[model samples]
Target: MRKNLAGVRNRLLQVVALYAPGGDSTRVRLHRLRGVEIGEDTWIGFDTLIEPSYPHRVVIGRRVAVGMRVLILAHFAHHGRNRESSEGTMDDRVSVRIEDDAFIGPGVMIMPNVTIGAGAVVAAGSVVTRSVAPLTMVQGNPAKPIARCGIPLGLDTPIKEFYRRLTPIEPPAE
Candidate 1:
């Protein structure tokens, strides 16, 4: 009875933590408590669902942004014709890793055993069936690369760099 209560308590805490107003740090704290490995400065947005079946199997790297309503699944199961028997269904848990600086857009569905390479960008509503290459941009159903990024700046480019490139810098007064 005590064991069951403890499990319930933990589950409750996870749910509460996900929905709470606190930002990425709060989410990381709760997820770590549930055994998911989320790296430094990563922000998992609201309504994102990490794999419940094998939370510990998911590893999110530093500076990653997982957008709202993203679904990261680590387990898959499908029952065959003989539904009652255990052999009829193939059930497996696979690890998922998102490398540093990747951006997973809203409503993306990342399947089991997938690795999103560093600096990759997954467009909104993409269904990723295969692993993405580093610095690529993928989109659409069973996502295919629509664009490949150029070589990174030989180092990490912070998020602010993107905005800086977009908006023109004012020249100093002559």
Candidate 2:
């Protein structure tokens, strides 16, 4: 009965968080209350769907920005057709960790067990399949590294300097 109640409460909060009246603070507060480990000053944009199954497994670090329509999933939710498996949490499920100062662009989908490194940039509409390295910028369906960022794109970092310091990665020989 307790478990069921918790699940229901989580669902309610999820819905509220998605369309909450306030900005980042309101969203962050709701998500944290629902079990997501959101750090200081992180921004969760409109309509972002975080882990519904295991919200505790999704950890967002300091100053991270999750764009609108982004989906960050932590578990598969359905391991198989087995009733027992569906009823209980998967023991082997891994957490999806987004480290400090990362920027996840709009429409990005991050899968479970992947660590988005600190200061990494995931471009708009990308589907992150694997772990991104620190200070790296990635884009595309499978999210490949596009450039190495010299500084994290934060309020403190100068816009011109950030752009100037980017080192684009040469495409693989085809």
Candidate 3:
């Protein structure tokens, strides 16, 4: 009763916070989300988009950080193509998942049927066409692994530590 009401209220607040202009505190934007479970304390940045379009489901693990303008698509509804096709069945939609503690940078794009392992880092503007392994750091257009996150890149410090110290600089508003 009371707990149910509170849960509903909280979800409504989250939706409003995500869509309201100038409301920057909210972390996630969900559209037609179904069967996907998002973990606790995850921070989904502004302009991030997520959609679940398949029966297999899309799952998001805890403590994940998704950067602004990142696009996570679980499926492609090929309704237009299906209508034109002579075949009775159409190959359309797939599921996607992101494991715990994963960090996806801004402008990153994740396609369907892929799972991002825990502690993985996807670089900015990278297009993730395949599954990323755990604790790995991937970059580039096709999102290849440049290095492991916690492994030393030569300076006796891990690349993950370097990324942790980085502060993204915001541009001046027009």
Candidate 4:
């Protein structure tokens, strides 16, 4: 009964956090209560979905910005390799980590077993399947690195400086 109650409560909190009345703070607070390891000053935008089954497996670092309609998953259900979950489901446990100063653009979907390194940028509508290197910018279906960054594009950084600091990824030699 206790375990079931906890699961119910967690789902309730998740539902509230999804459409939480206030700003980032409210959503962050609610998610924290639901067991997501969120760092200080991180902003979670409207309708962002963290891992529903195992919120504790998702970690967001300080000053990270998760944009609207983003989906971050921390568990995968592969039939052959799946492990039994406490919730009576079968899944493979994987952590989705976003390091400090990372920017996840709107409509992005981050799959399990991947980390977004510090200062990395994931462009809008990208689908991230692998780990991103620190200070890199990525885009597209599998999120290929487009450029390396000198600094994170935070609220305080100037847009011009952000663009100026980007070094494009050199094409491979033929």
- Candidate maximizing TM-score: 2
- Displacement of the residue 37 alpha carbon in candidate 3, Å: 1.5
What TM value does model 2 have? 0.90
> With candidate 1 superimposed using the best TM-score fit, by how many Å does residue 147's alpha carbon deviate from the native?
0.7
lDDT over C-alpha atoms for residue 101 of model 4: 96
Better by lDDT, candidate 2 or 1: 2
Extract clashing residue pairs from model 2.
Answer: none
What order do you get sorting by TM-score, best first? 2, 4, 1, 3
Q: Higher lDDT: candidate 3 or 4? A: 4
Residue 72, model 1: Cα distance from true site in angstroms:
0.6
**How big is the positional error of residue 145 in model 3, measured in Å on the Cα after superposition?**
0.5
Better of 2 and 3 by TM-score: 2
Q: How close is candidate 1 to the true structure, as a TM-score?
A: 0.73
Task: Give the range of the ten consecutive residues with the poorest summed lDDT in model 1.
Answer: 85-94
lDDT of 4 by residue, 1-174 (tens): 997998899899988998886545899999999999999888998888898878888889999989988999887754543455674433334479899999999999999889999999999999999999999999999889999999998867898999999999985679
Q: TM-scores of all models?
A: 0.73, 0.90, 0.62, 0.89
Error of 2 at 126 (Å): 0.4
The residue-by-residue lDDT of candidate 3 on 55-167, one tens digit each, is 22567777777787778776666566345345433334336788888888889999877888887888899999899987777888788877666531222346677666443
lDDT of 1 by residue, 1-174 (tens): 995875676677667655766557777788777767888888787877787645777899888888887888886753342245443322322369999888898899999889999978888999998999888778899988876655321125654654343322243569
Clashing pairs in 4: none
Which run of 10 residues does model 2 get worst, by summed lDDT?
81-90
